[model samples]
Target: MTRTVLVTGGTSGIGRAIAARFAADHAEVFISGRHRDTVEKGAKEIGAHGVVCDATDSQQVAALADRLGKVDVLVNAAGGLPEAGPGGRSALDGLLAQWHASLAQNLLTAVLTTASVQAKLANGSSVISIGSIGAERRGGSYGAAKAALAAWNASLSAEFAPKGVSCNVISAGYIAGTNFFRGQMSEERHGALVEETHNKRPGTVDDIAETAYFLASPGARHITGQTIHVNGGAFTTR
Candidate 1:
């Protein structure tokens, strides 16, 4: 059966990889981005449908839901560090801007998008939210938002488990080949990240994408409300 899948923030990076993964498997895939051109281009390149939507906007999210029927898989991949805090203002104002931006982008994006399409989720569906290693360390505002994401997933899974839906968060660490750092990552920082991993290599988008595929598979049916870390031993549980 061809499952209908939706991947937000799919224009590039991890979301793009996820969309391509499902599309390659002959799934009915749809990807969304805040920009029309990027969304269309990404959909074409990945052989999936594209929709222009800023997940942060309620009206746009609602319209997106109206465009689709029941979705068998929902990947909330829309999230990242915010650009440019309220600079030149008071330090408090800057801090507040960063916090608000972090929450809106990293946490609220997932929350709003999920709530808008909660009714459209098919039975036995899988909802996967992208998280970050920052949550486990000193990620500041961004990290805090991701931590909240994991917390929210626990509750969301409990609510959806009875309906045969599985909800989980993937806490990724130091993934490469994405504009995640927005060109701000220095070579020293990049090297530091790689060295922190036991494997001495940065994580790839495919690493996360494959895990997501497995979570949506029958093998992972029993997995829910868990934060699966894919950081190459950068962070581990005892």
Candidate 2:
């Protein structure tokens, strides 16, 4: 049977790639984004359903849950580093804003969306929350949020495992072909990031998409409550 899948922040980059991968396999995919145009465009391009809903907003998330009564796969891929706060703010205020925004975007978005869809997750459902390699080191506010995400995934797995559902986190490294840097990363910084990886090359969105696809497959049914690293050995686990 074709499974129903929901991917948040699926308008571009890693999220969009994941949505496309599943759509190509003929899954009933629904993608969400904060903008109407991007969501519609992405949905059309990938032949998946589109919903303009910010996962960070509770009301919008509730409406999304209503629209998707049940889902077999839920990919929480909506998150990114926010630029500085509004101009003319004190350093402390700006710092606080950055932290709050990071938490809301990276951590709370997954929390709220999953909570809203708790009941809608069918038996044997799979939940994959996208994390960052920044959580390992020098991530600053964004890293903190991602660290908390992995911690939450542990608890989430325990809760869902009893119901035969799998919940895990995909700790991704520096992936190319994404607007993640937003044209802010210097060429030197990019090279440094790539050099840090064992492969000496940046990752691709497809690498992550394939990993997610496997985590939801029957073979991965035995895997749960784990953080799978896909960062080309950038951050090795002991």
Error at 64, model 2, angstroms: 0.6
- For each candidate in the order shown, give its overall lDDT on alpha carbons: 0.93, 0.94
Give the worst 10-residue stretch by lDDT in candidate 2.
Answer: 115-124
**Which candidate should be chosen as best, given TM-score against the real structure?**
2
Q: Candidates' TM-scores?
A: 0.97, 0.98
Candidate 2: regions farther than 4 A off: none
lDDT of 1 by residue, 57-166 (tens): 99999999899998889999998988886457998888888899899989988998888889988778999999999999989999999999999999999999999999
Colliding pairs, model 2: none
How well is each residue in 21-69 modelled by candidate 2, as lDDT tens digits? 9999999999999999999999999999999999989999999999986
Residue 120 CA displacement from its true place in model 2, Å: 1.4
